[model samples]
Target: MTLAPVEYAVIEFGDSTVTGDLVPALTELVETGLVHVIDLVFLSKDADGTVTVLELDDLPEGTAAAFAGLEHDIDDLVNETDLQVEAELLSPGTSAVVIVWENLWAQRFSDAVLASGGVLLDSQKVPQDVAAAALAAHLASLD
Candidate 1:
């Protein structure tokens, strides 16, 4: 079988302004056959300088209800050690959402490449703002 492409993202938000919609959004992705969420983790730094970590199973009752449709086993691809490294960058009283997702939409393409004897290459995501700027530059150059 061709290997599935995986991607990870870490998103940070101020504690007072945070509203987590990841579970519902991920559910939509899974239902749409776009991506499969392999891992979901929440990290928070309190004002008292203490850090908190939780996986899907550890979420609060009210919050856990939102993730009822998760399709994969709740696991961590970005483990504790990796989370600690990232936690150091968070400001006090801030929170972050970490997710690892497989590109379900690309499996067919990956299989085709493998069938043609082509090796998989590195893949990376372009930050949205940077991609927008790039598109603007290309459009300007075409004028």
Candidate 2:
């Protein structure tokens, strides 16, 4: 079987935003063949500098509802070291989620490129504001 390219992302949330707010979009991504969730971990830092890591099965009722009926390929791929990194970056009173996912839709294409002996270069996600600015500038120049 061809292996999907894996990617990890860390989402930091302010005290106001909760996991529930972000679930719908992520569910849609998985449903639309964007990616497969290999592991999802939520970390909350207490005022006493304690970070609690919650796996899918350990999620709170309200938080678990976010994954309502969504497919979770839970592989427990994110280990303690990953949690430690998240803990270090999270604020004492804030929360964050670390996600490890595979780009399922890109597997075949990536395999083909590899088969052709092509060296993969860099991949970067353009910041939303920068992309918007570039688009606006191009449109203005065309007008």
Candidate 3:
């Protein structure tokens, strides 16, 4: 089977809690076949900067239940090194979620490019702040 482009993200929360508020949006993406969740891990950093990785069963009952249905295609794809890197970015009292996903909708385009002998030499994502600033500048210039 052709593989889609995979991406990972670390989302930090101000506090040490997983409220499952994003479940609905995530479910919608999966339901619509836009993306497939590969792996998801929750982590928390204590006041002393100690990081603890939490399993799904370790979450609050409601949160655990909310994520129970989101299946991972491959487990532990986000390894210890990945977690350590993301943990360094979290504040002492904060928590974070590390998610790895495949862009399912891009599979067809990727396959077509490969079939046509096109090569992806490089790819990069602009930082959110940078992209937002660029958009704002472009809009202002048009005014």
lDDT tens readout by residue for model 3, 1-90: 877999988889999886788888888998999999999899999999999998788888999899878877787888889888889999
RMSD of each: 2.5, 2.2, 1.4
lDDT of 1: 0.77
Number of the top-ranking candidate, with TM-score as the measure:
3
Local lDDT at 103 for model 2: 93
- For residue 53, give model 2's deviation from the true position in Å: 1.1
Model 1 misplaced stretches (Cα beyond 4 Å): 1-3, 16-18, 141-143
Predictions ranked by TM-score, top down? 3, 2, 1
* TM-score list, all predictions: 0.81, 0.83, 0.92
lDDT per model, in order? 0.77, 0.79, 0.89
Top of the candidates by lDDT: 3
Please report how far candidate 3 places residue 141 from its true position, in Å.
2.4
lDDT of 1 by residue, 55-131 (tens): 65666666666764676554767888999988888889998877778898989898889889998677667879999
Model 2 residue runs over 4 Å out of place are none
Tell me the spans in candidate 3 whose CA falls farther than 4 Å from its real position.
none
Residue 113's C-alpha lDDT in candidate 3?
A: 93
